[model samples]
Target: MIMPRGSDQLLLPVNPFFIALTLLLAFAFMLLPFGRHPALPDLLAVVLVFWTVHQPRRVGVGLGFCFGLLLDVHQGALLGQHALAYSLLAYAAISAHRRLLWFGVVEQALQIAPLFFAAHLVSLLVGLAAGGMFPGWWMFLAPVIEALAWPLVTIALLAPQRRAPDPDENRPL
Candidate 1:
């Protein structure tokens, strides 16, 4: 659990480079052959949601659209399917950002579950409209997994932003 820092605390600012790197890593993780399972958490989507909620200016609809396009191309799926889904998720995150900030990471996950689920539904619907076959019921489970993993993602990503304890404050020498 990430302890909330006081408003007076001075923590390190988030670097755009690290955000991009983590997103890239998430994409690479998605490419790993997981034995054709559809229930795997979409790590990229999780990261997207994380940034969109926490840093709207850095990770907005434009970035989401671009990332979705890349994923579509990489996965050989219908173009605009993921684009629409990701953009929708970004929009939802931006809309809910303020509210999410008031909650803890675990509670935030519960609220975020619907966004992930809705994003998947948008993708599925777009694919269907494009004459693609249904991806099966397991696809729905992806959001749940992603939502459940939200707290972990939050903790990992926020580690760099957390203020370290001052070493000299505890010294008795």
Candidate 2:
């Protein structure tokens, strides 16, 4: 039997391609010009929240930070804004990950919603702090959409490793 819950527990192995593909897809989603709302979904943040919960070691602060900075270059946002938000979100994910797995998909989505919101909030906060003009209150709208999108994001993120759960191993309480 697998040992009680811990980092040592057998995690579903997440392939590097999973990470790369998700990030690339997320980048593309962001790069596509927005409609008329002046709001863009937090695609990278959604992916980070997913991996952080499902596979903390595979998706982490450095990855989040780099992705954020890369986003900065791609989207023409401030250089460090996304980097800080992503790193913070990663740290939060690792710390809360153990508790999150116990919750149902809906519950987990509720939990990560704020992390998604906060990551973007931090980005906006940093932008304002850095002398960038404050985006409209509508900028906050993306998080709401992001939170609603979490379930799909989780499925998309985990689809790469969708083997049935190990029958022999104990399920979480």
Candidate 3:
């Protein structure tokens, strides 16, 4: 199997527990007292999308839906608003996963920007349809910030898997 020029070395199999832990941590971050600022990034969305792309079989639309529901309950927003947005986001990420992996991290971030925007747009539209007031143009900033955080999140999340499995001195993988 000839590796692509832009691709990194093979990653270790992702641990399910780590995936869950990261998702929960992101959700907890979301629950913090961020004061409902429209411009605030959705860390959960970014992590969810990351896992969905990198481990689609393990973390798919169902997890996204469940977490989104949890967020809705916590935030007191329209019941299915986040759920719908996250489901669509996960689906999109899964669909793009293969093609996305061929790019460098920065290019991957550029490609993912639209998915974040679409998720936010879905949430915004759902809110508007539910008689919620528009959150102003600043709302768009959330997706941009989320996109910007993609590389950092990718590095942090993939760090554990990047280590050599055996770490033999002469066996450079």
| Top candidate (lDDT) | 3
Clash pairs, model 2 backbone = none
- Name the regions of candidate 3 deviating beyond 4 angstroms: 1-7
Between candidates 1 and 2, the one scoring higher on TM-score is 1
Error of 2 at 13 (Å): 3.0
Full-model lDDT, candidate 1: 0.87
Lowest-sum lDDT 10-residue window in model 3: 1-10
| Sequence-dependent TM-score of model 3 | 0.95
* Backbone clashes counted, model 1: 0
Model 2 C-alpha lDDT per residue in residues 56-132, reported as the tens digit of each score:
87888999899888888977888988899989999999999999989877898788878878887898888888888
**How many clashing pairs does model 3 include?**
0
lDDT at residue 121 of model 3 (Cα atoms):
97
lDDT of each: 0.87, 0.79, 0.95
Residue 125 lDDT (model 1)? 88
